[model samples]
Target: MPSSAMPASRTDLDQQPPAAITAAGLRKSYGDKTVLDGIDLHIPAGSVFALLGPNGAGKTTAVKILSTLVSADGGTARVAGHDLAADPQSVRAAIGVTGQFSAVDGLITGEENMLLMADLHHLPRREGRRVAAELLERFDLADAATKPASTYSGGMKRRLDIAMTLVGTPSIIFLDEPTTGLDPRSRQNMWQIVRELVAGGTTVFLTTQYLEEADELADRVAVLNDGRIAAHGTAEELKRLVPGGHVRLRFTDPTAYRSAASALRDVTRHDEALALQLPSDGSQRDLRAVLDRLDAAGVEADELTVHTPDLDDVFFALTGGTTVPHQAEEASR
Candidate 1:
């Protein structure tokens, strides 16, 4: 690797423009087994795109190919305005990757590690020190700047690793399960960092086993299954894939509950609680039809709450209740 340490000169970076990432017919294999089978992906510039799946679903393989760490057996991809294979150097220069594990060197002080990255980028000594100091402050690691990475907590080490990645100031980033082993608080901190990066015009390509993380951070999400993309959409759009979304109608009086239940044929009755669960897709049209029927029957529900299927529901329905191993791995670690 050439010195990653270099001051991004105005002329050097200013000339290059940002571009969306696109993959077509991407495929990869390991000897006898196929890992990625003709996957297609499109990640818009300045957006957070999340790739989700089970442990052996080829999420890492996709990331590796896009980040230039591993060769794809088939397919074509473009990253940061450069062809993934033809101009790999340009792609590498334009993107940063933070894998599941912390890349921080335990023996080096936090500040030194950052400065080292700056040097690797080929920044002038004064410029490298300046960038290092700025990153320490940005990541809230300034207080522990002089402390060796081994002395930092898991969260601090993770933050430092990301800060180092940002040293080169790449416009696009690949974060592979970045918060996999973090505590709730640390995970939230990382989320904030990701949001800030996107807000500042950096595009993020994230892969995680945490469905909640994808729901919370991604502008769009793609679920990979069996070496292929099973589903891709916004969180709400994906949730719509699973059934069982419904509206619960709570009546103030027994008379109203009875009337409402009779009016809606599929209404699930709960006489004791004075509530009826309707099998609704939770669409506005469905809710309107239900309300019109209630009006005709002269029945009114005191409380109406709509429940939509979440990512967990979609995951279970699509994967046959196979709990994603990544989520358990994250929780245990």
Candidate 2:
């Protein structure tokens, strides 16, 4: 529960870095439908934070408001040491947003798209080209700098979109479903880019439906459901919230399995596989306890593996197994 608020002045901020973003009682609604209900967010600088939800879960709405694309009806927010409402221009200056959809101009070359972003940032002509070239090279788009973005693959387009966002060198960037339609390899490539960004002290706030992506890249994640935060924590902590966790003991010898099953007293036995499954939280202490008891009873397992509920399980459990139309909408795009 550390504060994410930096001091009022940049000089003071240098001594103590505050949270890049902090919000309390952030509310937004459309007509009678509430999109965010008194939500709170605290994002630290230089870390990757993910917000997860199904279609129409208000993930998009939250991003819109935070990025200054939309105004919230109620609440207070601070971004990069500037109050969101009081100084929206400063907020806009300090952050970049790359939505789920590609923003590249299909008619223009990739480098032109980057230069356009530089122009939007108001950099001088020469400086704009320099920044654009650096970002293009950094994002591996140097080869296709002059190629029209329409010719690029889905992954390449997404990379170009992110590179454009960095033109202003914003301290924090919002990536809404950046890798949604990409293949496995492309998705992995995006993840590595995010890692490199954070390593260089850039704060990333991305929204995604891919559970594995969040688990792999995020230092912290929050599950948004029905206009509220259902759960928020590290991947392991969220996984522990669900119930399907166990330690499995497999044996080649039926007699040893049976002996262990008898000694264990409370376990599901698989006669065909000669395995005994004991409910566990998949914690080291729980695993150690199981091992010690087996040793005391002289039961030897041929193989042992710990199984814990993954992020998908946590997502389903927290979001009530609801599928939304937004996913379909994203697909058709």
Candidate 3:
């Protein structure tokens, strides 16, 4: 149970406003292989929820089931307030999906792709053109709107793909590995677009192998392993589950540094830098205890910094130490 003393702004892990997507006992399998096993999820309206896992861990399967592209073996789901199994047409009308592969037609111009999506949505010709123009400009593809998608760079193609998806202006969107092949700048641009969409009341269901992307963008993150959710919570809450977090105390004064080094015997020391790295969970109680001990020893430090396990650590610890190859490369950089 969480402490009642915690502020209301950041207290509950499961507490949320009305849901945009809900699933219970979601299960799927192919022949003898099970992809998702009794998975459950609740994604709040107008928020970014990230589903994270290694390759082939059912991330795409979950997205497909919810988007009504693939049927689940067992589950009850409601998307955009409509029963997914009962009212798939209504669900489809309220949601958009952008898969790992680019949906852009290389033979067609970016404007053409947008207009195609508009046509699929059965928009009026004049309204379709207006929406395409507005979305193209919003995604910074107005200049290249007339250019063939084949002539666009990888990043530009991705931007155009998302812009085309937005032509229908669905209330909810599912982006599965949306930035897998893009450059760092392009990935960041995609993140910004997600933020703006959420700000405008769009719910985002994001599935990615990148822990950094989840940590930076998601209000809630669920880590899946072996077709089941290993853990689910806010970023900080998940990080707290793993060990190896610590607080570093640095001192400029030789005497104070020496005193702290002696008093804190369990610390990892960097003598040349006059820093003592104390093993801790980076909790408020732990910080208070460390300060009380230092005061008793009459040692004052120059600076303090807390180091905690990042989403990468939490991911590997829960997901059998496996990471996506591309995400690992980006993390190193």
User: Which pairs clash inside model 2?
Assistant: 4-19
TM-score of each: 0.88, 0.87, 0.88
**Per-residue C-alpha lDDT of model 2 across residues 1-333, encoded as one tens digit per residue:** 334543445557676656999888889999999999977888889889899998999999999988888999899989898998899999999999999899999899999999899889999999999999999999899999999999999999999999999999999999999998899999999999999999999999989999999999998888888888777777887776777788899999988998899888579999999999998878889988888888998988999999988999888877886442232222111
Question: What is the Å distance of residue 36 in model 2 from its true position?
Answer: 0.6
lDDT of 1 at 115: 89
lDDT of prediction 1: 0.87
For each candidate, what is the lDDT? Answer: 0.87, 0.88, 0.89
In candidate 1 the C-alpha lDDT for residue 77 amounts to: 94
Off by over 4 Å in 3: 1-16, 262-265, 321-333
Per-residue lDDT of 328 in model 3 = 28
lDDT string for model 3 (1-333, tens) is 477656764656446578999899999999999999999898889999999998889999999999999999997999999999999999999998999999999999999999999999999999999999999999999999999999998889888888888888899999999999889999999999999999999999999988899999999889888898877878877776677789999999989998988887579889899999988877799899889889999988889999998998889887876333333222211
lDDT of 1 by residue, 235-260 (tens): 87777667778889998798888889
User: Between which residue pairs do clashes occur in model 3?
Assistant: none
lDDT of 1 at 202: 95
